[model samples]
Target: SLHNSGLSGHNIKIGIMDTGFDTSHVAFARMRSENRILTTRNFLDGGNDVMGVPGGQRRHGTEVLSVIGGFDEGNLIGTAFGASFVLAKTESLTAEIQAEEDYWVAASEWMESLGVDIISSSLGYIDWYDTTQLNGHTAIITQAADIANQLGVVVVNCAGNEGGNIHWRKVVPPADGDSVIAVGAVNTDGFVSYFSSQGPTADGRIKPDFCALGEQDRVAASDNGGYGFDNGTSFAAPLLAGGIALLLEEHPLWRISDILANLKRASSITNHPNNAQGWGIPNFVNAINMEPYSPQRSLLIITPQPARDSVVFNMIFSSASTAILTVYDLSGAKVQEWDETATEPSTVIKVWDGRNRSNDKVASGIYICVFRVGDNNIRQKLAYFSR
Candidate 1:
């Protein structure tokens, strides 16, 4: 059925960062037969040892890769059937720590060099062994994310599965990186999984930007035998990554940020976003059919670094029309609204006194400014700091 519909993730290349993959596995046999696999690298050992445990540790990466592009019988079908892949082993089965994060950085750099369309990782780190070595802080590792974004590669990461069980809540890096699409896990019924991490990052940005089915999902096994079912934010993330690969195939010219913005826009909870489901579950079909996103003609903050009390929003439009600006805090609660009636095509500067409509100073954190001009809407994030 995956091939019958002609949705074979074709011409798209995805870079996967995880434990080693089982190259000899059956799920990828067709791809190997067709030479669809682009390249394989092991950032962990600097060797080409990508086969998981030579036959044992292959299950995890096999399942992850299958979720993104595996093809099989009536059992399960991946979102991107035509997509090719490059495997980058960044995690070690023995230890998960800050050093793994460094390996991921190296892997991502390699992915960019290959001009991959997307980077999907089922890895996240919250509590490293050495807290001093932790790179969860926003200021530290966001640069890596920024570089990936600038290279026109969409980065998708999993929010850690630590919500109900852990004290240090929220997603891990590079999921914590503002530019990455930090994904959370939900079930077929669309309920947030109890183990899905919660967030409003340390800098106060709503994370785990979207959710996907993670519970009891079918995945390919490295045994060259059959499929296995599992649950984790790991499974949820690749479902989205697979869907994104399809979207990119359809809209090749769209920027990574535009794709991300449209995904957030087409999510199930565009209006009622929260920490558990940032923009909610992304709708792949809707994202593909939607109008092409033009970030330039929408509302944007051209910067003075972080917005102090007053900030200017550059408004761009092709036709003269009325524009409405609404500001919301990290909790998705509306704090302010400004209306500009029948404005000409030009830039409009709107200032907030760092206070809510009730004349109260809003707490220092991250806020979203949404601008609506006719049917086109744009949203931008602004950081607020208070002494």
Candidate 2:
């Protein structure tokens, strides 16, 4: 979709977290010529060189980068070749270690400090971890990803390649993170790949929020300095991340929630998401052309602001869910609260008659109106003037 639009993720900074990279590949020649590789970090050794050992370890990272930023006329054109990049070597494919999680967390912090707008993580952790811990809040990496999301970084992670396994076939963390966009694999025909991990997190939340081409996907071959095809959810993650970069390039001020909501709204399966394919595959054309995402779409909206008698709180969400609307004074005191459920994909309107919990008229100058749904929290300012 970005091909003809002249939109190529220009000026967008994306952090790639993988084993390592080999920037010498010809596929990345254009990017190298343009100096689009902003910086690099090797969390595994605290070094600056992200190109680690010259074997299979760095190859994965190289191929992942190629899928996002590589460019070769008549050969391979990445989803966002014009975007800038920051590479981080955060894993060792040959080593089975527990500290890998810490490495990922450290890399995330470093990337955030470098002002990366998005993080494309093609790695996942499941070793020595229990299936029950697939809950978003359990894994340390998931917690770190959540923190990154709160800091306004869009984290895109692979949904793991464990679908064929019967023992434990769930998504890995930080893919389990609520705020992270976990991407699964799909074939060229847009069918779910057999290797893409399933979702429905241990906490009953949808995991792999999106899907992308992963089977036989084209990637730069680091060893041969050419292009090749790869099959894994690892490839799918970066593909989706590259598309996200294009969107962010167009909408620089959009937040994580806004991006996710728009992606869901533009996905192949808008409604009924499941563990196998969360919201299905995303279409870049549909997403970019849709209405610009705003926090009010599924967050909170205060109507009749600077009200004289009463105020209405309009809380919208993608689906039917229960939420709590609480009003707090400037002094951090609770003024009033209401609990209501939206029975459908529509607005849940709650009216307040300028009264506190005591049902008595209260004098209010400025107050904070907060509406919380699931893991999303939105706040709006409300002003009340007595009649």
Candidate 3:
């Protein structure tokens, strides 16, 4: 049996974009009481109140939010209940308009400025978009999603609930965006939901890059302030989004690309992803256990510290890369330098025999070891006593 990894998305910030949310539900009582909802914005009214008036139009967003951050012990626990949130009410309950897409883009930018690490959008736009425009770069929302990704935020969007509509069964905007994560729906039995959108973007890229339970998904109800059930890719998207948050919490230094790549690699159908299930359900626990992936720099671990004669430095790189390790004395003088390279995800070990750049034995004291690889510069204090 698989065991829990104890990751709860701590210190991670997620942005939820939809109609609005009801913070009065019992599932969200803990988050409300603890002040985990960092901020909110109602794009429909240009205000900060995303909760809206009582029960006016908060059902959809409320459910979506619950799937990610709602918490009620012994009842229902959301995927990333420990994560901070910034809510954006980008849709209207009365009608679906093109302006809502603009609101989505604006709200995403706002959330980015507020330092959100992930954006989970359960809303999609198709009123003004043609089937041919389902390419990754065509729609305005899709372009904005890519830009948000480039700006360092992981964008997660639903693959749309149009699978049953043969005439229009395809992923919606933003989900079709190359950089965004498009999630599809699976049932409790792990089978694809009948309504989850199918995708192979017009550009020929398989979409709904991940899958999650959406059928009869438990959520915080907006009607009577209790628990309920809902179904759609909307809920599935947030489930996966929350899982991404947990992964981010586990590997804070990992880049967005690293997170996505490893998650896909850990999915059930990594080697042969399809339109309906994409890469299949992701095993985040397995992903967390995968080798640490850092494309830009290598992780440094200096062993046998306070050395008398020699010490070993272990460096792990995610890809073919080179790194330089330099030791400096308290007076800012170079003591020794070591250079090593690796062609893949592997460790490089280097040993130093307490010598200077001129290959002569140096006086023992305290020294600083600085490891430089790509844009990462890691420094550690080392103590050396010459024999």
| Candidate that beats the other on lDDT, 2 or 3, i.e. the better one | 3
What tens-digit string does per-residue lDDT give for candidate 1 at 1-387? 334556667988889988878766666677788787888888888887777455556667878888877766576677775788888887888776678778888888777666577888898665543223223444234457666665557888888787876566667667777778888999889999999887877666788889998899898877766778989889899999888887777776566667888998899999889999889998877787777677446554535436676666666655678888888764568998888754566766666677789988877766667778887656655666655
Which residue pairs collide, candidate 2? none
lDDT of 2 by residue, 194-285 (tens): 98999889989987899999899899988878788999999999899999999888876466767899999999997988888899998888
Regions of model 2 farther than 4 Å from truth: 295-387
Runs with alpha carbons beyond 4 Å of true place in candidate 1? 1-5, 52-56, 129-142, 295-387
Return the TM-score for each candidate structure. 0.72, 0.77, 0.77
Best by lDDT: 3
Of the two candidates 1 and 3, the one with more favorable lDDT, higher being better, is 3
Model 1 lDDT-worst window of ten = 130-139
C-alpha RMSD of candidate 3: 10.1
